[model samples]
Target chain A: MARPTIADIAERVGVSKGAVSFALNGRPGVAEATRARILQVAKEMNWRPHSAARALGGARADAVGLVIARPASTLGVEPFFAQLLSGLQAGLSRQSVAMHLMIVEDVEAETEVYRDWASAHRVDGFIIVDLKVRDPRIEVLEELGVPSVVLGGPGRHGSLSSVWADDREAMLSVADYLAALGHRRLAHVAGLPEFHHTQRRMRALRDSSRRLGLAETVSTTTDFSDAEGAAATRALLSRARRPTAIVYDSDVMALAGLGVAGEMGVRVPDELSIVAFDDSVLTRIAHPAITALSRDTFAYGRRLAEVMLALIEEPERRRDVKTATPRLVVRESTAPPGAWQGD
Target chain B: MARPTIADIAERVGVSKGAVSFALNGRPGVAEATRARILQVAKEMNWRPHSAARALGGARADAVGLVIARPASTLGVEPFFAQLLSGLQAGLSRQSVAMHLMIVEDVEAETEVYRDWASAHRVDGFIIVDLKVRDPRIEVLEELGVPSVVLGGPGRHGSLSSVWADDREAMLSVADYLAALGHRRLAHVAGLPEFHHTQRRMRALRDSSRRLGLAETVSTTTDFSDAEGAAATRALLSRARRPTAIVYDSDVMALAGLGVAGEMGVRVPDELSIVAFDDSVLTRIAHPAITALSRDTFAYGRRLAEVMLALIEEPERRRDVKTATPRLVVRESTAPPGAWQGD
Candidate 1:
């Protein structure tokens, strides 16, 4: 399908394609978001840019690289990457940069992929997704002296620029919403234990429950999906002290929890409240729309472009920028309890 | 991230990236699917045969010109493209072909994008989505000798190759399923009136209902979204003689109907029954899994690749080929109407 080209991107962003062209070519003109979406589509088209000053040269085969040692299965289910990639692509597209995707089975493979892309000049820079408790990629990328951006801040603190979202506030909002709904006992179906965000969300949720004067229990899932969400939800609902609410690390998990509630004969917002992270369209139209923290993946895309450019322009200042704020959107899935419960 | 490189593609498909490169060059492949995916992905990566030939290669822009021809707003909300494009990408990824997308606001602009791409060699071919009774694009493409594929067949028995799910068979399956469930009355939520598939499905449904000895009522929607589907569903349910079952052109529509049933105080598969098309993940996980006529979009993509190549290779024999066949996937959404309405 012939879609809106740079000309359309230019029109929407209120500029010329040449201006769009200049911004995309890593020159300047047009706001960051407009440039990002153009870049995103350009990447989607696998469009490449050459900075050799030939003006719209061609593919370098040296794409921008991303290395996260997570399971390919896990990455597929995670909304963070889904949205983040969407954002990254948006930003990269305008620049006509290509993303060469690879899924390593483990950390060793991840490092290997990173080392190879670097030595082979397969990528100009790397866009790192997750930073581990002690992520080795940072050291590897630094040692290689290849340009890159970590998706997370230097945990414990560092010189690397990171694009971080506040899951803590988002979790606290979930707890606050459930507590206000008169729920005493609550449970959170979190993501894998090792993830940086999972820990942050779990800790924030526990603190929020205590702060809100509500009782809480927590469950961790190695897999963030509807199957695990359903299983976790079932365990909570079947207990003598069943939780009045449940929060999920993913919208997919939250979606699964809906069916689990249906299976246990529990009614949403009436018998139990539900909250999900990543307010995607899937969450918005869920039978009883789950309350969620809203972060625009599309806008997340815009910001990724900004940080990438900073890394390109002022590599020293890249880490100083903050990209997004996670905010809460209350919907039909969360409400006061027992109105439809089997009490 | 280093994924399967063109070298990997050459190895897997059992050809050299040069031969894989040449076949990908659209010279000829060892077989059909092999060359198609390579060419597609080559187009996607915006890869060219000669790096030095960047001034403009011997071929076109590699875009499969798509003219929405409908209002842009209507196209965005319809998940058809989202899912369809996902399939299209899956198929094209093998060949590395990416579409140069454009949303034409007028008929002339629509025709111009094609001419510009064709004349300036901007696109290798065109992909016409949402076909009408006597699509003008077909005539235009024929005159241009441009290689193209239609998502839906034109009504006039044209000599163009098509890759469409058998909507007629799917509609009849819905009627037969309802009849076997002992439902005497049925309604269909067909898509846009001018759409060829919608017309085909509606006519088949009316005929099938009569054959099954049941009365039929059909409603049409310009928007093929869950929202409109739900609204149409609500209108039918509110009627004095509401049908016992509802069939929809898409799973999205069926999902909307599910919400409508819930809002109308109708318990699904009890007071009402539902069936849908496109057995997406949503249908599988819906509270009661939805019954549907499922077609593999993945396979559809792969085959579309084959057909497009055929059009490329033997343009004189472009009049043959159907890529997808609709099949029944029975699930929880269809059942007898209570214990009283037995078959």
Candidate 2:
């Protein structure tokens, strides 16, 4: 496709190429009025900057780096990260910002990567995911003076800009939905215990149960693996007083729990109700499609990328992006407990 | 953790720093005996090359690029790519070769990205996936003279080095397995028709059926989405003579097919036998645990990265790595046709 170039914008605006360059680069030479006119013409011509040219010109690295601090095997199963990455790439591509993605073994290795990227100027900024409870990355990035945007939090991140879904609110809504469905005893198969969002969601689940005066609530931690999820379901179901409804922290885990239920001959929504967090194809395609906490993950990623750019370009300004709480999408999974038995 | 530096290796070997540098850089000054000793010392000390330092030294980029051509939504659901990426990352990390990953919209855009990365020298080479028949990328990469290794192929790819699983052999094994179970009629729900592997597998399936003298065989294609897989299954099952056994191209799609079967009150193995490709957590977690073609995708990715590196480091080399054929992991999903009816 023949995309509009700076020369085209310059020709349309009747300005010299140098003047257009000054305007585009936000340099001091172009008059304010001339800059506005050039920008308008450029926008009209759909002139997108080429990252390589910009990189060569020494104006910007035209790239952002994201270091995922997790084993590759763990990264493989989690669709959230992939979806978020896709959104980030889509958003960054619009501005011609390359995404430098890397996976690391731990926070220590992750910090080392941050240091390396910063020292090398390999990226203009970073997008931090899987924020831990006093995330070591915040301090490392701060010390390195690398512009960064955290993907999760409204809590303590030491002034770093963050884009986060309201995990607390989402958890509360999930609990509310299950409670309203005439469930008394409830169990939550939570994800990795250390993730800030996981801790936040667990707290929300406990607080909401207390606030709503639910009959019973139990929570179990997991590494978010399908096998672990299934094991957690089995453990929960075997308790002295089995929960009538169960909530899973991820779609895969929820699907696993459904399979476990099938193996155990516990009919869904009749003997028990199931709900899952983070909706995806797995949730939608299950035998009785799972009711899940639905959020726009792609949009969330796009928003985070935008924030990261803003943090990089406008260092003086700090922006916190908080996505609305994930809403409950009630499919076939959840129903009033034991209602079918009455029929 | 403090990794050993070149200085440490030099000190340990009782050699001059310059000699160590020469040996590590593969430069001419070091004597043959001295080079061997220095290399041995460096290996013992674990003095791995730092990519950024390597880049600044006027060496190659020390980075391999992998660009996924798919929408983010599609990328998220498919565990195969993520697992492959994990393996690639794990493999590349061993050699301290950075992975530059990106996602593009289509083959056309994917080609443009190749051009951009090559012209900018952003990557030393590429590990290409989702190979198409007469793939346009082969020619573009050839023209650019960019070192690349295609992930899937034993077919035409313009002499580019490729790493492939024997799709044909895997398909034949799958067909033979089903046929041996006394299923005369079979249906295959394949993924994305344009993918070279899909075509190869389809041909293999046909040829194998003919060789075995099976009563019937039918094939359908989908975009690899769960919805499409379910629809394809529905369409196949509604045929005048529904195949007793079915094969799916992915674990997610297979799980969806199972859900569809549940909806139709068609019992797995009892009423219909099902097989899925690319075993992962999804296949294992399903109600009856789908029988699938199991391969070490992580190792596959790792092998591809190693191949890409070899291609980049020695451009004159044309190395084709063929991974072992995926073997069938028998689970509860497959059984003799109408075996449950006798009970």
Candidate 3:
């Protein structure tokens, strides 16, 4: 626990504490070489200026702020946030940005969260998530003039820059893959209908299935959770003729489908071909690995961070509709309908 | 984007701005009914007290802090933390604590990080993780008087309280189950050497295996990741006479191990029985569902949060060691050697 203070480093380097502070803060007054030297000494001494300390100087603070509103429980279960956060951290690591992540339970709470954070200068910017059917955070962020990036696709909130996955394409690809395997009946396990992305993806899956001239079956669940996924699977399997393939909105639910299949004495791929959106390992270990619309979760995180950085550094930059093509990984779980096909 | 503001609420309520602030901040001295009227007006106007406004008082902010020295690329891939976080969020919901999660590239960087956050009060306390050998954070945390709880078991840090699974009991239980099933050649796919929990868990696994009179085999990996787990499985299977059963540190690795079995045409339970610690869906979905040492990840998380809260509420309270016992979940993945085995 030998934490070397800035004072100790300033004393060793023979610099005024103010000069050291300026250098540590990356202020323009310090010479580049001198700043580099101070940084080097700080590194050697393992000195890390606090986030709370940095924010105190001016607009920066005893506080670090981010604009987020969603049930904390919902966000925690979603792998999307986890992956994006990993990416966000990667970008923030080069600098000293202590994030203050808030979990406002509803739209009403999000409206005031922005004002409070900005008033206290507690946050640097908002990391807007789950852009809603009528997201008010964008208006609040813009009115407050806080730097932020929308984490979903281009929305009615016209002015903000955005980073989002192509959920429509991801869903379309899943349907297309299942249809190609000579499966006429397909089912989609979708997320909460209220979420903008979920609605978009469900629409895409249904439209794609219609285009493929296949039987399109869609079931909606409030949660993108494994337990709900299992329940959906149970419903699908209980029918007189189950769909040859089922597509899930999340890996958690897709993982649950495997259990439902076992309990129902249904063989994966043979009796029930299953495909999911995530290519995570949960799908891989199942007997006959599930064919999936796979995207790199790590890459998703990295891309989100990149867009956030762009939002922070070049605020005026035109918001781009950056899309990642959800690539499909054809694993063992998807095979041509060999048995248990609905006529 | 019509985010309502405090001013909007005050105008609607016809109240002084200070009164609105007082009522919203939950400060005393406001008439109870008047506060009720203000809250109702705020709710009617859909007003949110901007999070930035939270910075008006003390140095200790509303955000909780988390530091992980593990690389960002790896952290995103881990399901354990994701699940634990979900549980933590459930607990945090009870108190409304938002967390600042950071993933630094190395230990020294992480050390400086804690110092910065502590001094600046970026977070009132921290949920310290990945307990390493000779941890120095305990003293630093003590000096700062920050509320902290370690994720792994008690380590070189003597004072900080910890939350962990009963590694010894988990090991003993797994060994007993396997032994009862008549497995003689037992192997453990242990995690990294430097991780404090890994050492304890591995030591216990070996000791228990020896006591059971099984031919104990051990393989070590530097990562508690899926890729390493698969590689370890492949190495074990490639051996001319592989052990009857193999144990994995995590569910992801076990999933990858299942993949190796498929690739090698080695049957599970019959040819290469497996048991994994830390139950999550990866192991749950294996074709022959992996029988695992299922400790409720959600429960573990809620329990961890409760302990941290206890520590925070009464810092003078003596630090206690709390552990969750692992219960056997006998899914399709485990069976007696050559009895109901995959082979």
Candidate 4:
């Protein structure tokens, strides 16, 4: 069967094609009763506007682009990304905007996608995540002149609007909590070093350690995978003098580190303590219920979508918003350091 | 700077507008050297084909649509979805095809989206997941005459291509494994009852119990959320004559059930056994490490993308490809029932 067009609807409703077009576009010059009749006939005939034709008439794409440059294997297991995605969808779907998503190889490929989508007008705006130190995407987005929202940053976005949580404060709170529990020897399993948030977290730990006159503090970087998280934990525990407390950058990694501790006969909260930087179902349902920095990631994503929509509607009104700081939620995982256990 | 145009590229290359067009479209009309020079000039000027114009010329959208009808909050925690999404991106990105995604309210909203996207020609094809027992979208898609691949089905998709795993056989294997482990009274915590795969799994356990002469087999349904999964488990364990072994439809639910058992002083693999229908890092890192039915979900997603691409390229070559059935991987979570543990 042939696709129903405006002409078909017009004929069925005993109206002119021009009147049907005006009714469908919700423009003036059509009577209210006639518009309703036209719409009913159109729905009955299953008529839909050709999006390309609408695009030619300067209609909005009604979609946003999210290009992630990360390993797919790691992404699947990480609740952070999934929850954020769900949240972003929740916010965008309310406004009838879809998300055009892609996973690219690296920053360079990601920039190319931005250029392509910008030129094609495939999306109304872009939502950028995983902000890095001296990020290159910011400059590219600036040059493209596209309305965008950076998911990370209190600063360093260079005029781009952003929605960020206080990562440094969150990390410092964790360090303070562990230090008060007499954990002088501290260690951190961090994510990729290039990310701004990772640097903030590492610096927070170092500053806190120096202020507290701690014996030793170390930060090891990984690719944010469970394998790397477990390996990092193994290396830390294998030392002749292992730290009494360790913090992981993500819940998946934290859980893996907990498993490593179990395998090595290190009783959590006794000889050693563990904390996760992010909280999800994984952290809550674990055997000992891992201690974690808790924040609502789904709500964060919704806030991001809200920011993007606002920016797109009024690109001239740039805003930098800071969200609530994540609070440390102590569970069954932390305690005062016991006498040093030799390897 | 204003957007670059083909005419501007033609002027720079000192070629006719027709020659520039031919070279840009990869049509054989311009000489090889001239074509290369035109391409170089076009790239230097950052020229891109306007997608709307290309669409009017009958070019492919270079995208696929995936409209999900589940709640966004539940979706974020499900590893099965996150893994499949990653895999689908891995496959589609290989060919530079983006996934246009939307989360809608229900089946009616989802079908409306299908019709809108199909009529708009905004995607090359559609990838449908979570097939229903009496799906209405299948006929809508058939009437639209759009190329599509159903991710669930051994049958029931009329005149459409499908790539499915043997859900019934996979469930049978799980039931057999539990029955052989000396578990008699079995209960299943299932996903939404309307889903075809859920029905298959529930029926498999029922048939297996009758054949194996097991006592008191039952299946309870939920909306596939950790909250509901926990509530269902709580109700089951509170019974005077609780089942010796329980199977959960997802890893998150299984983990939640483990936590509940701990809260209730039920020893896993001793007084009660647990099995999850899916597996991921959640199962692996759990203290007791849940026994689960496992499949390579990422690879399954890639396979779906491949099949959708094939169906789009040659719509006449309809195929119902069967992928490998998921296998049961026993972990520390399941064992024989020890002398009845009275509530």
Candidate 5:
């Protein structure tokens, strides 16, 4: 059977092709009764609008693009990504906008996807995450002239609107809390050195260490996987001058670090303190319940969606939105440096 | 500035519109040098093919739809979903196929999305999850004649291809393992009652109870959130004849159940054993860890993606695929009933 077309619907409804198009597109030209009859005939004929034709007519795609350049395996275990995605979906779907999601290998592939989607008119706008230091994608997105919102940034993104939390301030608060507890030596298990937020956090810890006159403060970067987090913790703990407190960039890594501590016979809060930069159900349910910088990631996702919608509705009305800083939620994981015979 | 069109590229390159069209679409009839020159002109002019025109020309959308009907909040903490999504992305993106994702409120909303995407040709196919008993969506999909792969089902999907694990056998294995450990009184914390897998599991537990002559077996339905899991656990523990072993449908729920046991001073594997039907890093890193029905969710997702691609490529060749059944991995969470004076 041949697929039905607008002309076919027009013939069946005894209307002009232009009138059929107007009715199907919900334009103002067609009368209500005529439009209803045309729609009935169209449905009976199983006629579907060619999306490409709609695109040519300048109709909204009703979708947004989210392209991430992260390892698939690592992404599955990270609660932060899942929560953010769910939140993004919740907010976007409320506006009847679907999310066009993809995971690519590197920045080049990611940028290629952005260009392809833009050229295809596959999505109305784009949501950029895991903002990189001196990000190359920003330039590409800017050139594409597509409405986009970066999930990270107070200022680095050129012309693209952004929804960001103050990673630097959030990190500084953790350092201050640990320092106040008399933790002189500190170590951080940071995530992906190239990420803007990771760099911000690392810089914050260094600045805090210098200002507090700590003996030493070391920051180790990883791919935000539990294995890498555990390995980094092992290397730090195996050292002669081990830090008294260790902070992780994610709850999964923090949990892994805590397990490593147990395996090494170092009691949490008694011999070594632990902190997680991100919070979720995992942190709250752990036996020692690791301290974490808590923020509502789901709400953050909703905020990003709102920003993107506003940007798409009025492209000229671009703005940077700084969300609330994540505060440290102390649990059973942290303590003042106790008497340690090993050190 | 106005957007450039194919005519502009053709005029600039001194070629016919047909030659430019063929060259831009990577079609034949245009000489290699002419094709290259035409492409260069098109690029210089920043001309993009109208996606609608391409769609009208019968080009693939290069995307698949995945509409989930689960609550967004419950979805975030569930490792099963996150891992599956990551794996699906890994496989689909390898083929340069993006996923059109949405989280709807229920099956009605989900089916509505499928219809909309189908009518608009927004996606080449769909990957449906959380199959339910007497599924209404299957018939709708069949009528739409869109290629789709249901993520759960050995049967009950009419004229739709499916990729499924043996939930019945997986549950039976867990029951047998606990039965061998001398747990006569067993209880199950199942996911949404409407899901086909959940029904299968509930029936399997019932069958196991009868086959083994167990004293009592109870299965409580939940929304698959940690809150519901904890509440169910609390209710079960409050019973005068509390079961010695509890099986939870998900790791997040199991962790919450474990926390409930801890709060009630019911020692795991001693007073109350716990088991999670789904496994991830959470189950592995918990204090005592958790015995779980384990499968590679990431691999499962990749399998779904492969099936979807095959189905889309050859719609006539429909088949149901049965992946590896999840195996029971015994950890510190399960044990035989122990000495207890109070009970």
Candidate 6:
């Protein structure tokens, strides 16, 4: 008969993989009864630890864990991750470290994943992204004693190191550029308001709009889907007093906005100037080649991975990295508000 | 002293973590001399396998492997993967199976991954994508005695089960619809030619175009980047005898084509109709709501995962799944040739 695996033992014991891992590792988290049951089942199955598995003896796995808590629908369309992953892989590959990725639906489930990987020693460390205002995962990871590097900011992570792009400054540049182009009324099609960076960018936009003395700046929240982006555009365009310029948090949203504008017979640049936050292929390929706050996302990921490795190898060497400010790339989508007076 | 880790041994021996895994497991892939040295070093370090890893034995890891060999930049913006991944996760989560994802650059490197994962017993089976004309990974996977499910057609896989969409039928539908719309001269922006589905779709397009007695049907290859799509579109549009309609392999490419059309003073659906494959939010949100070959991508992913799990559980069950035929969604992007007589 084939040797028994972890799944078999867990199934027999009526416990989770995490629970089994904890019990086997003699980790304190598992209940005494549960541990005993798991041990008994494992022994009955005649499951002997593979010699290779035995040789490591509490050694590092030389791997890092990354868990994303978002709907797959949102995760798939967002270019942010793909670019970041590439950069992360580039850096991690240098150290031959494996990246174990898991996608969960919420903070609670994501926390569970952390526990599972931690108890198993499946990963030496972690790289966290899309940090919330009061992220629960931070505390859980801390308790696990696993090193982690947050992508957004370090403010709420206790002592965890962070890497961030000055999105606030980038937003300011976007608002200032739009205002300079004689755009009075403006709209901001923003991402999920819960994320730290989204909140920062929105705050920057509101502050900059107030300072610019613009007539109004209406902001709408979205799940970062193209459908929501179009709906937001439609709602903003149907307004009694419509905005002349609109800034989107992502290139996909901006492209959707462009499509909405076209459908509504709004001439881009002349009637409704558009600005996108990230400069992705979508922005570059758009009709007017959308104006955007561009930064090297690949480099951002690579830097975070480098920091993660450092944190894992030397827990005391906590450091923060501030990515270069996003530069505004002026494209065909932006123009003086009254350039085409006929409209 | 701290517990000896895999990283330290790898560093000392100047070999890879994969090599160490092979050597310690008594796996035949490692050289005899290298294996001897690895065992010696592991003994000297007083490294014994962690109980957590050892408990796994010859048991199922409750995980399946997925490897994507693509340029990260292209992978990031492509909506197809994101949508599919959601489905895969949905199906796998239901079965409590973990999906282990790896991104590699080429087929050879991809083969190495299959070997490593197989030797380590990290995954029970694999779900392969981007199947080439004569895939090397198939042979290696078979040799490793690991069950696998291919995402493309099963024809070239030497007995491996597969799950695929009827892309050929979909391509034919696309051609038939465009022909009915009175578009004779046509252009198709295709994905990487190495993939079996790309070749099949191309063949179907050519056959249907010939059967329909079209004036000409020219095709261009792209790496699926919007830039390449736009370049292909530009080259096609600049032709003296330009096709009235263009079909793109992906929505991102079609969006790029739209931008090129706008720049070249061509109006979509009026002067030049556009059709995009694999309907995405970009297609739905586009100005004219681009005509596309639509399919349930999430469902596709879910089904593939389900099949992978089945393959792992019952290696004797070699089933082929044909994903539902893509329905042609006629949006505003396609119309009779020169519908705008003025143009």
* Candidate of highest TM-score: 5
lDDT by residue (B70-95, candidate 1, tens digit) is 54334323344444554554444345
Q: Give the root-mean-square deviation of each candidate in angstroms.
A: 11.6, 8.9, 5.8, 2.8, 2.2, 13.1
Residue pairs in collision within model 2: none
Estimate, for each residue in A1-343, the C-alpha lDDT of model 1 and write its tens digit. 3333556656665667787787777877667887787777665543333222121242343246665454433433344555565556546645545455554457777776666555434456777776665776677677666667777552632455677777777788777767776777778898777677788888887787668777655656646767777888888888877888888888888888888888778888788888888777568667787888887776775587667766765655547456566788889998777843424
Q: What is the TM-score of each candidate against the true structure?
A: 0.64, 0.80, 0.81, 0.94, 0.96, 0.79
TM-score of chain A of each: 0.77, 0.83, 0.80, 0.93, 0.94, 0.83
**DockQ of candidate 1 against the true complex:** 0.10
User: lDDT of model 4 at residue B289?
Assistant: 84
What does candidate 2 score on TM? 0.80
Name the top DockQ candidate. Answer: 4
Q: What docking grade applies to model 2? A: incorrect
Candidate 6: where are CA atoms >4 Å away?
Answer: A1-56, A183-186, A209-220, A226-244, A256-271, A338-343, B1-51, B218-220, B234-244, B261-267, B338-343
Q: Candidate 6 lDDT, tens digit per residue, A144-227?
A: 678889888738677778888888898898888888878878899999988888888888888987799888887898988888
Instruction: Encode model 5's per-residue lDDT on B178-294: one tens digit a residue.
Output: 889888889999999999999999999999999998899999999888899999999999998899999999998999999899889999878988999889888987868999999
Span of 10 residues, lowest total lDDT, candidate 3 chain A: A55-64
Q: After superposition, how far is residue B313 of candidate 3 from its true place, in Å?
A: 3.5
In candidate 5, stretches whose alpha carbon ends up further than 4 angstroms from where it belongs are A1-4, A25-36, A43-48, A339-343, B1-3, B16-19, B22-36, B43-48, B339-343
Indicate the residue-level lDDT of A272 in model 6: 92
**Residue A78 shift from truth in candidate 6, angstroms:** 1.9
Give every collision pair in model 5: A52-B52
The fraction of correct interface contacts reproduced by each prediction comes to 0.00, 0.37, 0.51, 0.78, 0.77, 0.25
Cα lDDT of model 2 by residue, A1-343, tens digit: 2346678888888989999988988889988999999999877665656544554354566679887767777677777777877788888877867787777778888887787766555678888888888777888777667788888888677877888889898888888888887787889999888889889988998898898888788889999898899999998877767888999999889998998898788998788899999997678766688999998888888888789888888976887888878999999999888854321
Compose the digit string of candidate 4's lDDT tens values, residues A1-343: 4568888888888989999999999999999999999999888888888888887776788899999998866678789989999999989988879999888999999999999988887988999999999999999998888899999988989989999999999999998998898888899999999999999999999999888888889999998988899999999999988999999999999988988998899999798899998899888877688899999999999999999999989988997989989999989999888866422
The model with the greater lDDT, 3 or 5, is 5
- Residues B1-343, candidate 6: write the lDDT tens digits: 2446677888889999889888877888888899999999988765655435654555566677777777655555678877787688777766756677666778788887776666566677888888988888888777667889888873888778899888889989989988887888888999888888888888988998789998888788888888899999999999877889998999989988988898899988888999999898778766667999998898889899888888888998887888799999999999988943322
